[model samples]
Target chain A: MREVILNSYREAIRDRVLLVVLAFGVAMIFSSLIIGPLTLGEEIRLAKDIGLGSILFFGLLIILFIGNRVLYRELNEKTCYLILTRPITRFQFIAGKAIGLFLTILVTSLILGIIFISYISLLTGSLQITAFLAVIGVIFQLTMLVGIVILAATFLNPFLGSLFTIFVYIFGQMIPRAILLAKFYKHLAIARILSIFHYIFPDLTYLDFRELLIYNNPIPLERILFGFSYAICYSLVMVLVAGLIFERKDL
Target chain B: MLATFLFQRSIPPIYHHSEPLAFLPSGPMVEVTTAPLGPISPEIIWLAAIQYYGEEKISGGKFEFLTQVFDVLTRIDPLFDHAYQFGSIVIADEGRSPEQAIRILKRGLVKNPSSWIPPFYIGFVFYIHLRDFAKAGKYFELATRRSGAPEYVYRLAAFAYKKVRLRKGSILIWSKIYQNTDNQTLKEAALRNIRCLILEEYLEYLNKGLQRFEREKGRKPEHISELIPEYIDSIPTEPFGGAFKYDSSRDSFISTTYLQIEKIIAYLNNKLHVFKQKFGYYPERLDELVAKGVIDFIPPHPLGRIYNYRFGRVIR
Candidate 1:
């Protein structure tokens, strides 16, 4: 499992795709320093905004496109056949892949984060913890998203898997609001259906800490713990489901 | 985020959306603009707004896009207290959007209940620009109740009431400013406004009575007392513990202090006549008159005691 994790992480990093994403993220973050001064009195706020926004956006892009392909590459390259022949169970394989994906997103977000934080620290003359907190939330959110993608990949092709995963992530965040909106439009039937969907969906909004960071609102420890716990539990369940499905599949 | 941009609610093209925030920017414009970047959206928009404001003067003294600019900014970061306050000031003073400024500040007050400056600026918008004294007083009073409100806010509240002739309200505010302020200049100014308000109230009272007396008796009344139990119930007492005097020649009410000045002038005139009779040519100065023994002494004027006296003409 450790070798699987390291090889997968190294393989993903060696690709040109991640490099371009990192370059874009870096360029965007630095561009904010120039864009921020054009803004009137809120230069710092704008700069911080650009740094966090670019990191969140590009990091998520990596998860959506590159992240969905993690297990697919193993299956497509026919490496799963050799791995399955070994003593390792299907659960261990999926778990290793999940960890590898986690490592990949961690490295991606960290590079982008370092570049962003360095630029911002130079601007403010001090390190801002808000961006770090927001990045932490983004990392957890992407991890959970990757877990959902892995579960989808077990049942569908990589393209359909990624598409469905994006839908699930976005719609999950909107489920609670959709229920409220259904009620507001006075459709009791739709509202009830949406409430059912709300209970089943993994709310991505739970991990959205950008507003809290930008506004400098108090972030209680319990809230962070709850969000992190939610991501862990949800992703763990996805990995278990994916392992169950992959176990039944004929290589 | 891209999805938010694709199907983003478009701002209604119409300038008038006279609903809840009808005068406010359309909901579509605000939501779409601020939805992308989280809280940073407001900071960015606020900066953009500042640049927009600074780029050009309000053409023809009419500002446009004011509501959209601030609405988007505040909607992006509702806790941006300075943006709302500063936006309102800009809209009112520079943008010539007094109505929009009032609207924005009121919204700011709702979001930031603890902020005193919003209501203070709101009061000024109504008081200084709109000329809606009643609304001005209401907002000023609200401002004064909050923490960190300035000493002059209370004065403004009272002054607003004073303008619509709410004597009790004016007096209350004036008395508050007079007693509350430690600054001598501010206290003196407040006292002056109060005294002038009081004098105005007195003059108004006498004018009404005089008009009524003239209508009834078919002539201007010789004394304000003539109106007692007829046109007026009773005479009004001077606020300074002095009396009001009726100037028959001018057909106006004057302060009784003028009477003392008049008496001194009369005495001086008699001495000048005596001096002119004794001397073939009139003395150019009062001290010269004294030196020539025209009179025993120069009678001091009541208002300007021992003041300079010079004649442009020789008294025949």
Candidate 2:
């Protein structure tokens, strides 16, 4: 399991697409310095928002491009066939690949986060601890996304898998709004269906702390604790489900 | 190079431009489309709006889509206070649409209920752009009630209240500021406002009494005291450490400080008239009055202005 995780991590790190995404993320953060001062004294806030936004956007891109292909590449190249014949079980393979992709995303996002935090401190002449917490929120959101990608990769091709993951993420973020809309129109049946969907999917909005960074507000300790537990639990369920499907497949 | 230059010149010189907000979907459609991106959509739009405004300012072009851009931005990010504030300023000043600016600010106020800044900006738009002091006062007063409002909000409320002739309301706000502020300058300014408000009421009362005296007696009163029993109950004391005095020539009462200055001007003109009558021509300058022994001495202007003889008139 350890060797498979390391090998997958090394492959993802060596991907040229990862470097391009990271470069675009850094460019976006640097461009905020020019765009932020155009606002009426909201320079620091604009920078913080754009910085965190770049982290979330580029992290999602990494997941879509790399995490979406992590499994399909192994199967298409017959690498999984070679590995599955060894001592590693199918669940270990699935879990190890998910963890490796997640680590790549985590490291890439951390690099972007460090640059953003450093840039913000240079602009404000002081460290922003809230910026750090907001970056963590982005990481948690990407963790759930990587899980969804892995789950989709089990049955769908790379293109379809990416599309599915994107739809699920968008729908997951809109779960609260969907529930509210359902209740607003007084559609009890729709509300019940949305409630079930809400229970099944990860709510990406829960892990979005950009507002806290934008308004310089503090996140409560309980929310951080809840977000941590929810991301871990959701990712574990996704990986286990994908493992089950892969275990039963004839490939 | 020559071909490129000629081609560029051949192209018609662009005389007009609109902001890129024309590409935006309607509010609900935009919300549905950008729902995937969440807050990033609004942030991107806000940056675009700022750049458009800056370009308009540089080029001195009318903001054709300023209201539209801001409307779209605030619609997506309802709690974006800076967008409301800066957008309203550009719309009001550059777009020439104060009403639309106020509309955006009011929406911000509703969405950001806990924020005092939106209401403060609403008051500013009403006061500066619309010149509707009553509405300005109402918004400024609302702002003062919101948490985290600055002390200056009270001052603007008082000023706006005064413009609408709500003297009591104005004085009430000024008194609050005076009582609460620890800054010496602000405290002094509040005190001055209170004194001026009282002075305004007193002057209005005295002027009304004088008018009544003139109507009833068919002559202006020789003194303000004469109007006490007939017109006013009593003469009010001056607030600026000066007594009120009657100016029979103008048929009005003025504070002593102003009367002193008016007397100096009147004396200089009187001397000029006498010189014209005696010499059949006016002196070329005020100094000639003293040169020709028309008066014993020239009194200095009380307002630190040099009196000049201009075209047979004593002017300062």
Candidate 3:
């Protein structure tokens, strides 16, 4: 298990994809300072908006692109055979890789988060503490998405897994609003189905901090804790189910 | 996950029916036809009235219906920010009910404690339309204390307080802004406007004294200083580093000494007109006109307060 963890960490650190995503995220944050003035009364608002948006978007891109490529690259290069010959279990290997990539995302997210917050403070003469809490919330959301991608990859090729994960990410963000819309249609059957989707899907909207940042509203601590718990529980379930599926597969 | 899969499969496949009900006569039939067939559940009707109230084509009875609908919408979703904004603007600006707008905005604030937009609009309505500057200043102050209130709002509140004669309050607020702001143009503008306001108040007192003198005497006063015993506490000094002068010849007042040149020209023209009106020819000398009683007292030129007993004639 220790060897698997160390190897996964090294693989992610050596990966050039992480570097590209980090550069893009940083460049976008700096660009916000230039774009912010054009928005009239919302200068600092636009800065925080573009900065936070870039972090989430570039983080997701890195996760999907690198995460999908990791396992497939190992499989295509026949490195999985060498790893399997060792005493390490498949579950340990997958868990270590997921954790390693999660750490990479956490490091990158924090770097961008600090820079964005500093920029906002310099522009507005006040720091937004809520923005930090919001970044953590978004990280949890992405973690759940990473789990879903790993689970999908266990049962399908990397390409299909990445596509399915992206679809889930998009749908997950819309699930809450979708459920509300379904209720308005007066179709009990449709509402019931939507409710089921709501419960099963990891709601990314819970992590959204754009409104709070733009409007300077304080975030509720209870909601943040609840959302964190939801993400953790959902990701654990996906990973465990993926383990069960992988254990039964011939590969 | 299994529960969700089972629920999806449990509903009857009505969507797959060959003959769909197209022409539903009654509401119940429409409901039945539109009901979700498979595992999909029907959408819930959450505050349907809100949608109807937002329609722009509503008029007369429809407008009244919309108000009721909005009330229902607010009751259902008290934290709906957009509803409060639209409803408050409609009631205050269009309906001309500042009281109703205030009540609605207060209710919205209670539900959404973090919102600043409602408080900003509340101040705006009171300041601009109702002209209740005191209430407007209070609301604007509250908005500034909030997290998202813009910087310009603070300046506006200071101006409003000044309009309502809250001089100390206005000066205090503006002083704080002047200290914090780095924009030279904005700072200078604020300082200049405040000075002008202070000067205007003193000017008002002088004009009121002049008016009281005229009311008592039944004609315009000969000089502003003559009202000192009756209407004024003491004669006010000129504000812009100039002294007041009284002209006995033209029975007029002037502020600065340099205005005497224009005053002499005006006095000469007036005496010429009087001479022509009385004797049908221009007066040969200023004293000749005074001797003839064509002018009991030669009024001073309107510009200069110093008497200028000069003679002149009109060319044509």
Q: Give the alpha carbon lDDT tens digit for every residue of B108-200 in model 2.
A: 888788888788878877776677898888999999999888887887888898884566655665676577544343455467667867877
Native-structure RMSD, model 2: 15.2
**Residue lDDT tens for model 1, A1-251:** 78777877887788788899888888888886677655544566677777777876787678767777887888899988898788888888888887887888898888888777777778889887787888888788778887887788888887888788867766776565566556767899998988788766787667778666666677788888999999999999998999999889887
lDDT of each: 0.70, 0.79, 0.62
lDDT of 2 at B218: 96
What does the i-RMS of model 3 come to?
15.4
Best by DockQ: 2
Sort the predicted structures by DockQ, highest score first.
2, 1, 3
Error of 2 at A112 (Å): 1.2
TM-score for each prediction? 0.61, 0.68, 0.52
Docking outcome class, model 3: incorrect
Minimal lDDT window, size 10, model 3 chain B: B37-46
Name the candidate, 1 or 3, with the larger lDDT value: 1
lDDT of 1 by residue, B10-122 (tens): 64434221122234345434543334344355655666676555432311112356566776676546667667666775676555679988877887788677667778778
* Poorly placed runs, candidate 2 (over 4 Å): A178-196, B1-16, B28-32, B52-64, B93-96, B129-132, B164-316
In angstroms, the error of model 3 at A9 is: 2.7
Each candidate's DockQ: 0.13, 0.17, 0.03
TM-score for candidate 1, residues paired by index: 0.61
Task: Report the number of the highest-lDDT candidate.
Answer: 2
